[model samples]
Target chain A: MRSLDVTKTAFSNTLRSKMRTFLTVIAIVIGGFTLTVTSGLSAGINQTVDDMLAGYGEEDQLFVMQASAMGMGEDLGPGPQPYDPEAGQQSSTFGQEMLSETDIEFIEGIDGVTNVEPIFFVSPDYLETSGGEQYTLNSLDIPADGPAMELVVGELPERDAMEITIPDTWLTMLDADAEDYEDIDPQIALGETVEIGISNLAFEQETVQAEIVGVSTANLAGIGGAPMPSYALNDELYEIQNSGLDVEQPDAFIQAVVDVDDLEANEQAIKDALQEEGLVGMTLEDLLGIIQGIIDAVAWVLYGFALIALLAASFGIVNTLLMSVQERTREIGLMKALGMSSGKVFGLFSMEAVIIGLLGSVIGLAAGLAVGFTANTLLTGGDGPLGGVGGLTLFALDPVALGLIAAVILVIAFAAGTLPAARAAKKDPIEALRYE
Target chain B: MIIRKTESIIELFMKEGVMSTPVLETENLVKVYGRGPAAFHALKGLTFEIHRGESVAIVGKSGSGKSTLMHLLALLDEPTSGVVALDGKPVTKLKPKAVSGLRNATFGFVFQQFFLNPNQTVLENVTLPLKIAGISKSERNEHGMKALEQLEMADKAKNKATDLSGGQKQRVCIARALINNPEVIFADEPTGNLDSATSETVEDILFGLHRDHGITLVVVTHDEDLAAKCQRRLIMQDGHIVEEQTGASTTTPTAARVPAAPGERPQEQPSRRRRLMKFGKGGAR
Candidate 1:
């Protein structure tokens, strides 16, 4: 029937008034932007949490060093000859095996362990640069050929010696002479001694010369939560360093960090093994709890702004539709005179509101992107708290969030349009026809 | 106008067609504005009938209920009491939607102010009744063009009705009334806003509708001359029909006095219907 066709025509025709239609669309778009961005940020934060709890990648082999088994620096022997490669690969000149009695066979029995090096290590003192910057050094326990061990320069240190591998942080904080370390070939190496300082404030007058060998990159222990303890190293004064701790042999070698098949997959088992071996490591629980705190903070902050924008846009729609009712009084009366029922007139105005809403959402996406991009770039500079956060989060483009924004804007427009549309539909034709 | 002369002969063999059918019937209709004792009674016990193909003029002074009676008959307002039947169907009790449908389809209305949907064009105004009734666009154009052709305003079809002169606008209003092929035409002060010349043109179009197409027409007017020119005239006073004039003869009686017998004026032939009322029959009316 033509009535149905006329309804669609009416919807299009109502939007034809250019100025009024433009304003209506603007109101809706603003509403859409508020709704889109708020929901998107919430969804984005949630997805990040899920990705983090998972362990390592799909392909890799691993082994766990329980209780001091992975400790590499504890065994000192042969009177500082590890700096010389002529020392045997398994010289066994050191008195004690770093592993306990039973760990060797038990670890070997599990399948797919192509090789296992029972690693050993000791805690060392904080290494201090001439400028007074301090950092602790960590040891590498994997094979010299293993993927975990990388040589920045020189060669891997041998067994039964004072020669050691220091992480990147230890090399970075140096005196002026070591600062311009561009060429490693003609640069420094082990047996070429440099002064290292002790930073114990109570007895802070200690300084000794140590030979530098291989350089490692696992220096920032705070980041991955690797273990560290204080110890001083000096090639010329090695006898004096052990004389202060003063024992022919010390007994505590009780921790190990096992590199697993997948770090995240075996995190629970690693945690269980550490419990069995009386050791501890950082776990996913700590990461998740911290992320949850950040998520709550972001949601409340964005939600506050969105609610304000939505309220303003809602008011605009109501005001615009009300003015329309007043402007078209005679036209409404004429429609009634031509035999249009109140319900049909109501439907026409409501459809007009929907058109306005859709237009606004489209425009809002553009406007929001403009503001979001500029704001994101400004926040992206690495000069403030939480600076260098990822790119302006694409809030509006998220599907669920965009859908929700559209739904909310349309509903707001529909609701705000009701009173004015009803008023137009219900005007008495006789009185309206008589109006000027 | 001469086409009605031909129908005078055709109705002779048809007794049912002789008296024709009353397209509009009213029985003691009343309208009271406001509520309780303060209500102003606009119409009181007004009764009338208009036959098919009849042109009627209702003339009265201000406040004599001509407009009120017209509005009630137009189905725009509810009558406080009594019945109104149009073409054998009771109309006084139908719902609002049904009333609008019946009026849009069956009755054409013109007003003194030339309420021609000022927002629309002359052609659009004429086509509105068809549109309201959900007629096809092509058919609406066809019927609207035909109505405009009848009024000799076809060339001015695209002009806005509000832009036309009172006379030209009324011509478009006449075309609008006929576009739906209404069974009855009701006009309230149709020429009241026009000059004498324009008023005559409107009256001419209405008379042509009745005579050529056999369509019924009822107009409420204060102009004595306009009222006097119709086939039937009614004078109302304070909601009462004080005077009425039956149709002036459209034909001359060929026979004198007696012998041809009782009720012989209407011819009875084999091909026509019996003396049956096409509209109201069973009630006391």
Candidate 2:
């Protein structure tokens, strides 16, 4: 018989015992649904991390600090230790291990290090628009060569300019009479000037005027949606905050951003060199590796469950086909006697199994996508649970992964069908015809 | 020895001016059911030839090897030792694919049970042989409709096989058997499951196809009246053809001798006329 006829007949035959076929397909559907959803979740998280990293900084730059700055180092073996005079030099107002000018010079001399720029720690107390209300402000320094921020309305501030970019959340704060935050437009605040107040060493507040060059969208990265100041503006603020002190101001910073040549190939070498100098260096991939590993582990565990469900579903297919073969013994004999080849008979049953797999996977794909997109909408909405984490997408479908899942299910189903199909093919026409 | 006997019979037929060619010829065919001591010899060195356009009946009681011989002749089962030739070609040596191909193209069968796929429509049932032969759908439908029309069952083509009456089902079977335009039609107790009226209708259809189309007919039955309608009858008993007769004479004047074997049934058997009278009396009820 022609292959098309065999396939058509096999599809029709699957409908003979509708309930059994439906139950088997449901088993496969469960597996496909789980696999699709989990893979989508993994893809979404990895994509979100990548987007966040792009906004963080340049790929060829590493953030380096004293090894004990972030409480990540060898065990200190208890609370207190004998204090060395050099310990005092490592201390700063920022209450962390600070890098000094000498440390920057030392890093600049490293083999792959092209340049080092100290990340000036500046805390502006409040921000006030011209003739407008004052609002508490947390600020970050924008490096001269850093990656561009995800801007919502305007461009990033020019290098070495006394300019600032505020998050969209500060738009309403910039309005003096706006009762509703939604009524304030972000574009109006783009060119406005704001005063940044910083406390000096003598307990007096110093103010500096800076232009709002842009308005950026809030995201989980970018220092928790803080306003950003250009390197020139940050330097002026830091200088003013330390004036009128009796003690000499230590030329130290919390960390330094180091540029390197060929970050992909020399990142580990640069990091190891820094480690020998009692410092730690982290690349973009290094910061995201732990998160990626966790996501991958969770995806693999879910895939294991899906595979187990598919294994059980394969047995269901075998049982269903075996029963069908038993019931159709006489029919098989009649077809064989009518000159249908054994290969055709085998093809018929295998085709039936594949049809069942196709039905299950297609339905599962539709179901998974429906749930995935719906969850994405609900969770990413302003009033939803994940709204606090800006630009978070919980599920993203991968078309290639979906196709692979369906193909795997089909292969499993065909393998499961071979036993019963072989039995049907081997039936003796005489004995089968004589069967009651 | 059996070859000589078969040659003489063929010579006799030639003398009678039948002028027909033999479509199926078997030489010393033997069939055993089991191994060694447990074996049941179904056909013991039987030799026969069925000619083209001839209606031959293999009449015997149950377990008398008539069905076995028919299966062997139809290429449905392999014989223990013998040659079953179709159109002078030894088919037993052919591969299974070739054997099924020959059966599909050249032979048709009607069984005691209708063996129709109950869920399928009558047209689908009738066109099964053509479908197995990989004929195109449009052509299969055209040929199937024509066969159904010949059986006067065109209106029932769309009806499920299970919905048909016994006589109608038998007619559908005849339609199926005729759809392939086979050279020979093998009917094994074609009317065994029908009433007298239905059986008569079925018998008429079988004989009509034989008479009108000149398709060779091989029927296996225990009914003497059915056997009487055939051109020739071979009466089997215990794995051997005990008597052979033609429609022209009730007595077996050209009876083929049974080769003698030790520890077997006697060569001398009851008269063919007496057996016919006995079966005819029983069949009248």
Candidate 3:
């Protein structure tokens, strides 16, 4: 028979036993739903990582840190160590790991290194705005030339200026105790001037004024700080902390940024150059890999469970088609007696399986994506459960991946139908017709 | 219009002097089941030829192998060893696909059980073979409607097969068999499941098809009364034809020359109520 007629017959026949067909389809729906959710989760996290990494710096820019002498045996990078109670109330950098001026100059001299920006650790007592509001202050140095952080309002600081960018979260930190607090609007703080007090180790305090150039959102490259300062402000703060004090020279620097000529080709050579200087050169790829690896591992485990569900669903299809064949034995004999080829008989049953699979997958995908998007909206929408971290979707469905998943399920259904279809095809017309 | 055109064409063929060949012929047919210790010989070298426009019956008791011979002649089962031909062409060596093609194009069958799919409409059941033959939907309906009209079941074409009476179901089965316009019609106990009145109605239809359309009719039955209607009878014993008897019937050459239309009602049966229905009009086409 023609394929079109075969398909029509198969479609009509699938509706013969509605309950059995529905139960088989439900099995496939469960499998499809699980796969779509897991895939969407992985896609969402990967998208966030991509956006965050690109916003922070160039792909080749490396974050260099002093190699920890204590965690030297662990080659996975300068990992965190347990904090000792006796080592309480330490500054941002230890004496041994603090970067000196000479060490920064040495890092600048390395081959294949475009330039280096030293990260200065500054301790400030308080930040006082013009409105008489004051709070504890934290800040980090901005690179002279690299990708700049995205601003929620205003513009980035000009080069060689006493300009800074404060986090939108800084106001929240100041109002932590205020009941019924609202988020700090970025528009109110744009181009605002704030006086920051810097205190040296000798308990001498000096205040300096810096204008806020922009309101920036939280980023992964912030070094765990709230505001960002330009090179000039960092220099002035460093001087104020060290002035009129018999300060000891630091042995190591906390961190630095190393720009490369061709990051992909020269990253390893530059890393070796930095390692010789007792430093750890961390690429954005390395940090992103850590997040990506964990996400992928979890997604795969979920996918494994989904695959198990799909396997069970395939067997359900097999059983359903097999039973249908058994029920239609005499009908099959009649068809053959009417001159339908074995191939046509096989096509009829396989088409039934395909239609069932297609129906299940389309419904499952639609349901999954609907539920996924709803969950994402609940978690990522303004002031929702994940209100603090704005613009982070928890589930993202990729069209290509979803399409591939559907196609694979269709093939699996077709294969599962083969055994029953073959049995039907090979049936003896004489014997089948004789069957009651 | 189609019937008139086809009749004119058949008239043209008769004028061309192409005649006297058997519609189907079987020689030394053998059918064996199982092998060795369990071997059962169903047909032992049976040979027969059915001429065009002849109504013949193969009558036997249970286990007489009459059904096996019918299956072999209809190409529904392969003969273990023998030669069967359609229109004098050797067909025993034909491949399975070729056999299926021949069956669709040249033969039709009505079984004792009717074998109508209960879920389908009478129209769907009748046109199924045409669909298998890859006929277009419009043409399948066109031909299927004509076949149903001939069987006088066109009014019930849209009704479900399960809703039909025993006689009505058999008529629908006959409609399906005639939908392909096969050269021969094979009826195996066509009235086995019907009452005496329904059996007589079915008998009239079968004889009408043979007399009207010039379709060679082959009936396999145990009923001597059913066998008596045919022009010739072959009695089977064990696995071979034991006797061949020619019944009392006028051998009119004019009846073969001018084909009879099948919608004519028999004198003994009352006229059926017209259901005011038309095939392919409201049914699934």
Off by over 4 Å in 3: A53-60, A66-107, A122-148, A157-159, A172-184, A195-199, A202-208, A219-225, A236-247, A262-286, B1-19, B248-285
- Give candidate 2 misplaced runs (Cα > 4 Å): A43-59, A63-103, A120-148, A170-172, A175-183, A191-211, A220-224, A233-255, A261-294, A381-397, B1-21, B248-255, B260-267, B271-285
lDDT of 2 by residue, B57-120 (tens): 9887777889899999999889999899887668888767767777887789898888999988
Q: Choose 1 or 3, whichever is better by TM-score.
A: 3
lDDT of 3 by residue, B85-173 (tens): 87776777766777777788778999999999999999999999999989888899889889899888899989999999999999999
Model 2: DockQ score: 0.60
- Docking quality category of candidate 2 according to DockQ thresholds: medium
* TM-score of candidate 1 relative to the true fold: 0.63
Which of 2 and 3 is ahead in DockQ?
Answer: 2
Native A-B contact fraction in model 3:
0.74
lDDT at B101 for candidate 1? 61
All DockQ scores: 0.26, 0.60, 0.59
Root-mean-square deviation of every model: 14.1, 6.2, 9.5
Which residue pairs collide in model 3, if any? A98-A252, A98-A253, A99-A252, A99-A253
True contacts kept of 1: 0.32
Model 1: per-residue Cα lDDT over A1-436, one tens digit each:
2656466546655565678778767656766666555565555455444433332232233334333333433446648644523222212224222334244444444343334344434323555543466555322233322223334555544433445454443443443455533323323433444444443223333555445556543311112112111122222233333344434533212222233555556556645554464333333334354665677677667766765676677677778777777776766775666676677677667666766776787788667656655554455444433232322132224576666677777787788778777988888766676677
TM-scores, in order shown?
A: 0.63, 0.83, 0.84
